[model samples]
Target chain A: MSKGWDPGLVLSWTVAVIVAGAFCWLLGDVFWNGLGRVNWQFLTEAPRDAGRSGGIGPIIVSTMLILLVCMAASLPLGVGAAIYLSEFTDSEVGFGRMIRRSLEVLSGVPSIVFGLFGSAFFCIYLGLGFSILAGGLTLACMVLPILIRATEEGFRSVPSEYRLGGAALGMSRTRRLLYLSFPAALPSVVVGFVLGLGRAIAETAALIFTSGYVDRMPSSLFDSGRALSIHIFDTSMNVSGGEAQAYGTAVVLVFTLLSINLAASWITDRWLYRESIGS
Target chain B: MFQFSSDTILFGVLRLCAIAAGSVLLLVFVFLVVESWPALSNVGLVRFFSDESWHPAGENGLFNLLPMLWGTLFVTAGSVLIATPLGIFSAIFCHYYAPSWMARVYRRLIELLAGIPSVVYGLWGLVVLVPLIRELQPPGPSLLAGIVILTLMILPTIALMADAAISNVPKQYLHSAAALGLSRWSTIIGVVVPAARSGLFAGVILGTGRAIGETMAILMVCGNVVQTPSSLFDPIRTLTANIALEMAYALNDHRSALFFSGLLLLLLIIVLASLAETVRVRGEVNV
Candidate 1:
């Protein structure tokens, strides 16, 4: 009985292996095709000849600037919402539930719809036009749900004993949150921030309209700038001989995402380790 | 007095931010309605459903979104069909068969897949999947290509959620099944799967939402032709693709019509999200 062949086990293993193999194939193909085109120059020079002959320097700058604006706008709002939901309001009640539901629906709202909204509300109504500011604000709306959810989980993990201790010491609620809960939840908040950053950086559809198609170096927040993801899309679809550059940009984007995710997991693991030791 | 005032100000600021965050969804809906009002009034809602094609420009322009709507649903349905079984099985393997370390690594891998940008997936689809499909058929970019790419894109969502669902199954049920001399497969199929049914359904619904909303990847591989796909190999365009492709140059009624398409997408997503939320809430209560 111990040695008999098990079809279920065999099938499951096969399915898992197939999925893993597909992932490896996809990542490997991108690297194999794109690595040759990436270098120091590619990282630091502006693209030329419609992105067929040069690097993605300006695109990288634009992506970073847009990410900066997105983070600056979303971090406070997301964290505040999380604090409001987790600390101030009862989760089982009306306003909290409504906020959570709205977030759920917003998270599920298609990025393309956000693109439309961003173009209408930010680019047109607000007169921001196709600029980094508009793109960042659009991403802020999109990233808010993810950030709030993760940060809320982090805040919820804080022991109530800590809060009680703060109260016993006559610490004000705001002071307790700042010195006790906020510090304790820093690891999760960082993880959430990194996740939101990754999403904001990888965004293409939401940024395409708001960020515009300009690939030059953006001098200010008001200037239109092409994002790395958009660059990848434009090169792959619009330009005829831009496959190499597209792959290069993709490699950069994937590596950025990989590093960010790895850093997040590392922080989570370290926090868990510290907890185990302290307890 | 200073401390109290400072605390009040901080709380006030945070409350304002939360309110702002919550109102964004409503604002998005209202703006889309306002922008699309012209199209809704001039073209009328009936034309949107009844017209023949999506010719939004020139004289006698047709504003029908049926083709794109069908394309979105058709592609989403196809991807869901392929991803659901594979994702469930993958989750099952990770939960029951794999060693703990392997399971951890595999779950991380899936998360990494989720983190990868949609544009990268789109690039890969265009360069790799499209060409592979082309060998099987004449034109490369087709509904099949879109489905395949979308299946890959949404697989991680389903797999991760299913994995969580499977993990949440109480250990007592497994113990009881084993005590009754049931086989592992039978325990999984009869007890664990049934126990996690609603959660898994929620996961599928969420994945469906993601697939429907996906734009760049599907846009790259679906050939972007505004036609009702006759077969899986035929070129098609999704509502998302239609909006992204045309928003650059569309004017007047054309632009308004795109906004209308977005409104439709928003409404569809809201329904899906609410359904998922309800299922999840019920599952939590039942568990």
Candidate 2:
């Protein structure tokens, strides 16, 4: 007998379509409202009146600077921690589990709390003031767990035979990890970086207190700078005339994040395809 | 000998990084508690949690968190209610109904959605969702706007988690259901979903954490009013929002009160996260 109309299928399809439609609507609305406002000037010129007039040049520079600092700080810490977990420690037992659990807990801490912590430690305790350095460090802390987790997954995916092969060659543990394991996990680690980049770009609250929301081009890491995300919040919340610029910044932010995520997936997909073929 | 020493140094560095990463969480707790103690001691812990008003600047300097706490709970609960069913169904569709290519695209799109910054979502809520709400009801920013934005934000988390849970259901269970002449829909409902219940529950819990912790998005659309919301249309402030909004200017008791609010949020998140972890562990054990 021909299957009558399946309500479950209908319901599931409806749900999927609704969610997908909402996503499309959101992206479309941002683009529709934001695309026209973006231009070369907007990308290069500094804000004139509290980001209410002129282009978001300084904001772009500030965002990139903060991201650069964040990546520089977090990459070593996160990847090293991941390597330690995967290679040196018995990750299934005591201290390793505690580390993993702590990462989990830290990841779940709200951005606002991180804002407070960032202000307390980096801005005040470290005497960085409301500077790019403090903001970047805060973001680094925020991203460390994600990076460690992703990089650890990469390290885990390396075949054990590589370890054995290295050992048979009388390679030291460091030699094995540096040349064999790390290279193999480099793609995954890159993926982690891209993910962290996306996060660092999107972060607002963590940077708001630490970064001090200055609309000027930063001369050094010590200088305060406004990020696109924080710019969006500031314009919409405090400023009266920066609404259009906020949309433009949002579009730029969304596009940047989307591109990073796409690059990440492409990298992971290529790696996985190669992995499967090699296997 | 040089190589060995270098290797030792490298390993030590890695171990140090790992230890530092682990200690960050403890440091966060310590800093928050230390900062929050001024308010805790000044107002006394009993009044902080028990009071209804959140006027840190008033003559009495009330730190009653019930209003903001209730606001957070109300918005979070509302978001959970909307997101859970939709996300679960979306997950089911992704796993079962969609073709392989469609599933792949959907997964990528969901990830993209997840990657979009919370601030963008807030901007969208302010420009689109808030006005939409205002058209239907005066005063654009309200609990409803917050809930809707939060529901959208958390969908990827719940959907992905549920999709994983659904995918992990044993193939044998489906095969057995098929052998019993149960339809695909019935089998999923009667067997597959039931088997994946704990995993789904854990997913929902994780989604709850995400929703509750969400600040900027809800902050933008939720009107940021300090009073407890009498209805979904009423504007409200969350604990996160309260701190974000007031931390810049707050001093003494007000500042400590914000820190104390942070402490309370930390506690709430810790509870939710541990519960999610417990459920996930239990699910793993069951499997």
Candidate 3:
């Protein structure tokens, strides 16, 4: 019987760590060189060098706008689907399980497929064109599966005692769900939103077709807009010498992802810890 | 019903949004049909599936997924070959050898790795991976590059899933094997892996789904060529990368065929994901 650590394991692990280390090195390079490019004008100016006159003001605003629109579209629907499956369905027959599995499949679907569907549906069918509304609506579909699964898992984690006790007191199903179940799962649902937000903010391919990749800031939902992800994509693809801007964009995007994930983890831990105490 | 009241109106809107979930799939099917219809009717479905040429802007000839399909499959198989052994081994090591404090930290690292966006991975690949590939080969963006990139990308998911599977191999089984005077190596290969294969298989399949559908990273690294790669060093395109690169510019039946590619993707995920569901049942719960 072998008792010691495998040298092969250590070697393979070191190789992976070194590769990951290279990634961090690139990040450092970006900060060292790319920081100077990310100033007040850089933030406020519309992509001038690429668009020929500029700041990232429009892209940031557009990204936030898309997030709001996407959440508005996906949240209620996903939560409802989660609730209908978790609370309403008879899991013994596998109906809830089937739907749950489908939701996971949906989560794993590449966003590009969602983008293709969006471009065809919202951009042409709905006459929304390459507008912010079209982009957000497309992403709404993309996030729905994740939201539903997370919400369901959150609701499932709530002990049946709470619901059984409510029922024993003759409370209605709807009443118990709204008053008790929703609050208990509120933390998890928030985690889902955070995940969805990070996804939406980083999304590029989906927005490319539906949102139509405009560089300028928009004042209305009907107007086309670009997000930070699209800005990075545009810089990477279209700009001839905007590697500086691309690195700057990557730093912003990476930081946004890391911070949001951290915040969600903190919220999740804090809520679970609080929930465990006598309540 | 107090239709004009704020609460009633709010409920009405929320209900509409909620109902739209059912419409979500319908919306996808209908939209793909609408966009792809012109192309479909023009070129009968047979030529579309049978042919392999990929000139979207060219005249009269638009059919065949052989190249892109081949490409996607190539990279996927390559990634599977790379990730499976490394990931399974890492999972086993973490489960058996890691100290408790280190296990939690390592697990978190895996989670963080999974959370990084595809585009960021593409960025890192472009800056680092491409150059490394180019140095060894004639030019960059070979299938090798894509494979290595994908292996790294899927490691965290595969590792975490494998660890869950390994952990599910009951402690008593290990102790009993030890009691029987069996070696640690024998216990793992004989007792642990065989017992938890379903979970490990599920994790591998999940990684496959990820590798097959990966778009952005392949778009950046896989040399956008429609050719059968003879070696790992050859630049090739994947079905996903093809769709991403060509979808925006495609017209007519080319468009329909692209949606068909999506349908194909849906079908692929459906199969593996169904298997993954069974695997999920076998593996212990993980967040």
Candidate 4:
């Protein structure tokens, strides 16, 4: 007998199509309504008018600062740990495995959970009181795991023979790592940084507790500023201008991310591609 | 050897710090349990697990997350239902049908999608999606809204992983199927799908982990309701949203419970991520 019609496939297919359709339409909607909200003043000035639906100057500026702060903290810590682990593996694979596995577990911990810890530890316990430092440190903690993993992968990809050759040529292990291993792995390590920073810029829930969504431009590290992600979240929930303003803010955030992430990804991808291809 | 003393000591401290990263994971569990002990002791473990209402630190102080759990399950299940098939299909097409040039372009777009933040996705949902669903009902931030947003947020991940999985299924398997008088279509369904089942599972697991941990987007779109999802268009909260919405005002037992919830959510991600990672390596072997 011929198999009866498999209705499950049909139903699942419909569901999938509808979901994809909704995402596509949402982007299309943004383009249509979003273009009208964009203006030269919107970029240069803070919300000159009262209420929300304001320009993104402050939020954009805050996000950039947060990125820089998180990068400063995570990069050295992450890369140093990676270098340690990768170098140690030549002699002591057991210790390397422990570091590697821990980094993996750390990466798996959710961002929101990190937000809680950060709030308790950074904002409250340390008396930082909901400021950029708290936000930056929290995001740094979150990104550190990913950065370590990526950098370790980069280091692992470098041929062991090269390191041995350097040692044989009278270069000390430290010098070998600094001049050869590091240089060889620098491109991928940088790629990891770019990826980590892009994620930090988009994060919100974590920032809510640490970053403090206080409106207007930041005066100092402790002054408390709004990030683009938090700004988008805060603007959406409120009743005032409602969906129209929310859409405008979203469009701005999306384009800002699109332009920056696209450039960063292109550069990183080309760098990684060249490394793989030349090898 | 002259300078080695200083540099070696530096590296020694660096090792302690590296090892300390592992301690942080254990520390999280300790901190959550310690901070939340009062509330857990007050409620007792049995009742905490059984109760369905979640109004901790209220006049009632009811801290039942069952409804939120139900909402979490509902939205995650619904999004998975949507993301899985399309991801698998697109992956199949990407693996077998698309030319190299188009494959690269599609891959790049998918990468861009991955790079876009969850908050932006939530923002997009709050703007366009919630209202559209609201047209179906009032207060557009419903379980439907959350599911739709999660589906979009999760699509790039599932597609990328699923593509990797299908690609991992060797050409020999497909060629063997074809040589055995099987049609291309039948060979794909019969041979490729079976071979890639583990990979597909990995993709779905990764996607689920994502949907589960998702906070900002779901928080923005899912109206903060402490009830089981009655309908697709009804407001509901998940564990993530519950923490985000309540944490700002929470204190004592209430805050502890939020910590408990966060701890629980992290444990879930760890479990799912490990499972996904295991399957991913196996899938890679197929390539």
Give the clashing pairs for model 4: B53-B64, B55-B62
- Each candidate's clash count: 0, 1, 11, 2
The C-alpha stretches of model 2 lying farther than 4 A from their native spots are A1-3, B1-4
Best by TM-score: 1
lDDT of 1 by residue, B65-148 (tens): 999999999999999999998899989999988999999899999999999999998999999999999999969999999998
Model 4 segments beyond 4 Å from truth?
A: A1-23, A48-53, A90-93, A242-245, A276-279, B58-60, B137-139, B277-287
lDDT of 2 at B182: 87
Better DockQ candidate (1, 4): 1
- Tens-place lDDT per residue, model 1, A1-279, is 254666669888988898899899899999999998889999999999989989999999999999999999999999998998899888778988888889889999999999999999999999999999999999999999999989999999898999999999988888999999998888888989999998888889999899999999999999999999999999999999999999999999999999999998898888856964774
Write the residue-wise lDDT of candidate 3 on B98-145 in tens digits: 676766776676766777777767766776778888888768888888
Task: List DockQ, one per candidate, in order.
Answer: 0.78, 0.78, 0.37, 0.43
Cα lDDT tens digits, model 4, B134-205, are: 887887889999988888878888888888877777888877887787755566688888888897898788
Q: What lDDT, from 0 to 1, does candidate 4 have? A: 0.76
Of the two candidates 1 and 2, the one with more favorable TM-score, higher being better, is 1
Q: Model 3, A1-279: lDDT tens per residue?
A: 346655545754664465446445645655665577777887777788674346688888888888889999888788877777666666446655555555667777777788888887888777999899999999989888878767777888888999999889876666677788889988888888888877777777777788877877798999998888777666765676766687677777777888988988998888867986746
Q: What share of the true interface contacts does candidate 4 keep?
A: 0.44
C-alpha root-mean-square deviation, candidate 1: 1.3
TM-score of each: 0.98, 0.97, 0.89, 0.90
Candidate 3 — what's its lDDT? 0.76
Q: Would you give me the overall lDDT of model 2?
A: 0.89
